[model samples]
Target: MSVLIENMTIKRGMKKIIDNLDLSIMDGEVVALVAPNGTGKTTLLNGIAQLLPSTYKKLEINGFEPQLLNFKRSFFYLESSSNLFEYLNIKEHLLLIKKNWQSEIVLDEVFRLLKIYEYQTLPIRKMSLGMKQHALLATYLISDAPVLLFDEPLNGLDPGSIEITNGIIQNLADKNKSILFSSHDIANIQAICNRVVFLKDGKIERDTKNMDEILELYKQLYGG
Candidate 1:
């Protein structure tokens, strides 16, 4: 039971973004997608989430082929950019997710966990970048999706927030959820990911569960 993509090929205009890529995220696992910029990390994530078009031999979630509504209900995708509504307050955003996704997670607990309870009444437009990031994190935490996809979730966060976010990721995996996130921070990847998949030249350059080996491999691939 995992989120699986096999023999996938993605293209953007004339340029190939992902060529014959195969990837999987099993239950109770956290996998880090590591690569230099323009290596198609986000493109691959979008393709799996079905947010973009791509051709694939097989794409499945928990052993079932992606059925639009079920797939949408089963996973959460956290974009690097904040997507909160300008007019909506923090609590309102949570309420919207609850209403739409039928999330069983409590809003107050999520706010407390993400340390954003005080800003619940403030409009997203008035919040700072860190606050907005917190809001995004809160939404993901409360979504209760089985699979989570995050792109640069630590961007713009302070050190404390980064620590909290890492803990949150671990907690989700402990609950048997699948997590696949892309991050440039090697330390964070080392701390949270059980496996690392390095992408290059529109394909997976390396995949390994050994943290030390992956670090060495990453340095060699990116010329550290």
Candidate 2:
């Protein structure tokens, strides 16, 4: 399975945020989208997910156009915000995904893995930011979709949770799931991702599997 985007352009009114961008992620590949803030990393993800209004020459997921309902079923996007129902409890949220996505994932295991089991009955509004992030991640884990798009997934996570999250991502890739995530954390990116796609000036500035060189390039690009 693979996601392919060709000749894509994203604009905000008169400003072009992503211009003629082309990229692909194959099965079992974990790609990190790295860029400084406000460089359209989020916009590029949204554009690929077809969540934003944009012009594209071609956009396909597993050989299906995104307009198809099956295409929608093929991928899950973990939004930056938790975006959970404030009144719903953690279990209810998991049940919602199970019902909607027809996922067979065991809620108990997911809750345990994310350390949200104790808060299963607690409403999202009562959870801390880190807890909410766990809930968001749990949803992605249970989705069982072929392509997973995540935006700054490590934000708000503690060091321990970040390690666990990295493990989860690696496991998913080992299962042949194509994952693309955006993050500003260079260390985490080097630790988890097999490929890095660097964005700048509305285009992919660099895409490489050479992690060491990419790290050096990142430091040079951002003056770290």
TM-scores, all candidates, are 0.95, 0.95
State in Å the error of residue 82, model 1: 2.8
List, residue by residue over 29-109, the lDDT tens digit for candidate 2.
Answer: 999998888889999989888889999899998778977878877888857545788899878888888877778889888
Tens digit of per-residue lDDT, candidate 1, span 45-145: 99988888899999997666776557777888856545678789879888888777689999889988988878899998998899888888888887888
Residue 130 displacement (Å), model 2: 0.6
lDDT of 1: 0.86
For model 2, the run of ten residues with the poorest summed lDDT: 75-84
User: CA lDDT of 149 in candidate 1?
Assistant: 91
Q: How many backbone clashes does candidate 1 have?
A: 0
